[model samples]
Target: MTGSTTRLFAARLAGTSVFDPQGDQVGRVRDVVGMIRARGPVRVIGLVVEVPGRRRVFVPMTRVTSIDTGQVITTGLVNMRRFEQRGTETLLLAELLDRTVELADGSGPATIEDLGLDAVRSRDWQLTRLFVRRGTAPRGLAGRLRRRGDTLTIDVDAVVGGVLGLASPDADQGATNLLAAFEELKPTDLAEVIHELTPKRRREVAAALDDERLADVLEELPEDDQIEILSALEGGRAAHVLEEMQPDDAADLISELPAEQAERLMALMDPEEAEPVRRLLAYDDYTAGGLMTTDPVVLAPDATVAEALAHVRRSELNVPLATAVYVCRPPLETPTGRYLGTAHLQRLLREPPQTALGQLLDNDIDPLAPDETLQAVTRQLAAYNLVSLPVVDEDGHLLGAVTADDVLDHLLPEDWRDADEDDDLEGTSGKEAAGA
Candidate 1:
């Protein structure tokens, strides 16, 4: 939903009602049947159409017209009479359902499951390959066959149709040679690959992936990596990705960039995303006020530990680094506002349900003031090894907390050094030197 490539996978239209060219109802899609590889143009295979009497028929993918949220539109009613049942030797639908396949060199494979695409050198789509179910090996002698022999020579279109009951037009180019080795990759694996790329390369890869996939990959990246990638994206796309990022992480990133750049990025982002960053930006960067996330999990001072746990479950996505739950008055404030002392999430989880946050609060907790420099902030953060250091004004009014990650960024150098150069004007007169 956040990145372009992810949107493709998340956009699957299965179970939608299929319609014919005349707009007559055909059947609902049971699943994505399969896809044809080695075909000139890649095509989707359709399968398992529910019919009258509770019967289901397998249909060729060629009959499909369009896929939408609730229904799949088809060109026409596939005359079931046209399809003859191949012998039992035919591959069963269950065998290929959600199965992963390696694309042969020079042939493209459409994903039966969602296919991830990566961009190489900023030109065209590079298929990252399919996500197949684990543990099941391909059946028959074909499983044992190596790169040689007729057994390895599968008719791509026929195999697709026979396996998933779909047909595809021939393709001009063959499947990508590099994709043949990767059967499937976990989201974390993909994130690591993205991490290895240069900033430009990362942008290319991110652009190729659908929104939801991009979001997953983004979530997996380290906070710093997320900042670099988002900074590289075009404004609109970057904004979309930021919208999907955890608010706390997103805020941290925006807080690091130059003020003008940060402001521009926030303006382009969706309001829900921009607001948190705006709140964060309002605080001084080196202080806890600037670094603390607004979305910390909090509970009323009087609430029982059981109620606190419930709040945590509901806010997990927003408050991942919830080292300690802050005990505050009713009505949670933005991190830039008031709060009380903190209680650890781990301790709360282990504590008795009847325990109140007020009883468990650590009275010795230290708070930070705004306008503190990076040098001082890092020292405190390092000394305490605190996951989150709360910030407050002179009046003891809470602002936000400085997160460990943000503090680390401030400690690191953001730019490369320039070679020092000396001018050779030692022998020149004062007037000459001034003129030069």
Candidate 2:
């Protein structure tokens, strides 16, 4: 069915337009699908085709007659049902992109940023080479990665000391064994890598992170990046990640979107998590209401110092929120709690463990009104030399607290958060390099 066929990197296959023999455009290659095996070769299974209107459909390999540079031709009818990854299926784009795999040698895991696919016996398609990037000096790479790290491509067998072939276990593989490597990397480190990727590539990796972990990485990325990744996700998935994020951070992200889209996403969030963000979105963009986070530490007026200290020790509290605890009256949720005052960490340390939190409330620092302008919030923060400032309503109810980071986000250059640094890994592959 083919005049000639040539091997190409799997990544190169992505985004190519697929056409019928009559020259009718069918779709584009979104991902390469393969069937993984326990003790045999992982065979090419099908192509995930992104069809207009339908989004994505599966075209089994048997349907295709030929695959060549930038094109794949089908010999039979293709399945119109959307592709759902099966137990035995591995989606190359989703599973292998930006993945770090254990090396054939015992040195450590090297990231498989790009992959090479060649025709087996010059006929069947198979992943043949791994252009791996190592953080440390190259080991079995024999200076290949270190010397031509930017452009060299080597067969998997060469790196694996001439193993049986791509079918063997001792090869640079896909996502099957990636949990261990990812577990060792901090969220910040992972975020740096994601930042360097295009929105599509970044999303593939982001989808792999757990909700809480994804929240942490989202917070580390710039606002533009945060929006891009979030926009790429389905509303429900975006809602789950937003629910895991700090209320203020989530609100800040929501505020950046068109009101309609933001509202749609917010509706997908849990009622409890959406409440504070909803309130924050009602305020002007430059007001304290917009910058404050509803997840700040809050304690009942009758609570003790020990209770306050323990609350601070809880897993979910970010550093700025942990710096002080707001002592409030009944109806402690946002838009209701009476603004009693704040209890500083220093005061908690000096007071007797059992002392009532209300007794240690500092009256000097005034809680900001939700309508207060950003300038006022800034002046108050500087006047008190504080990193966090609480926001209250007209009825004197505690709403949330704004941290210095939020204020700095506005005062800094519009592009301040856009700087590129590959990473600070002991042997970091410049922040932007690894992700690309």
Q: Which structure among the candidates has the greatest TM-score?
A: 2
Model 1: C-alpha RMSD to truth? 22.9
Clashes of 1: 34
Q: 1-436, model 1: which lDDT tens digit per residue?
A: 1112321231133344666545566655433334344433233344455433223455654554454455555545454421223422121222232233334442434323334323232112223334332222322222323222121323333333432332322222111111122114445555644554445445545655555556767866766677777776678877787777656557766766778877888889888668876776676666565656666666678889888787767643344355667776655665433567888788887899998888888757677777777677778767876667666678665655666766655565552111112443333322232221
Q: Which parts of model 2 are misplaced by more than 4 Å? A: 1-182, 420-436
Give the per-residue lDDT digits (tens) of candidate 2, residues 1-436. Answer: 3554656667666667777655566777767887655454556777887555433567776667778666787643545555566766776655664454455666555555556765564346676677666533222213222322343455665444332332233222323223223344456655654554446556655655667888989987888889888997778989999999988778888888888889899889999889878887788878998888887888898999999999998877767778999888877777656889999998899989999998998989878988889999999999998989888888888888999988988888766644423333222111111121
Shift of residue 37 alpha carbon in model 2, Å: 29
| Residue 59 displacement (Å), model 2 | 43
lDDT of 1: 0.52
* RMSD in Å for all candidates: 22.9, 18.0
Lowest-sum lDDT 10-residue window in model 1: 173-182
How many steric clashes does model 2 contain?
5
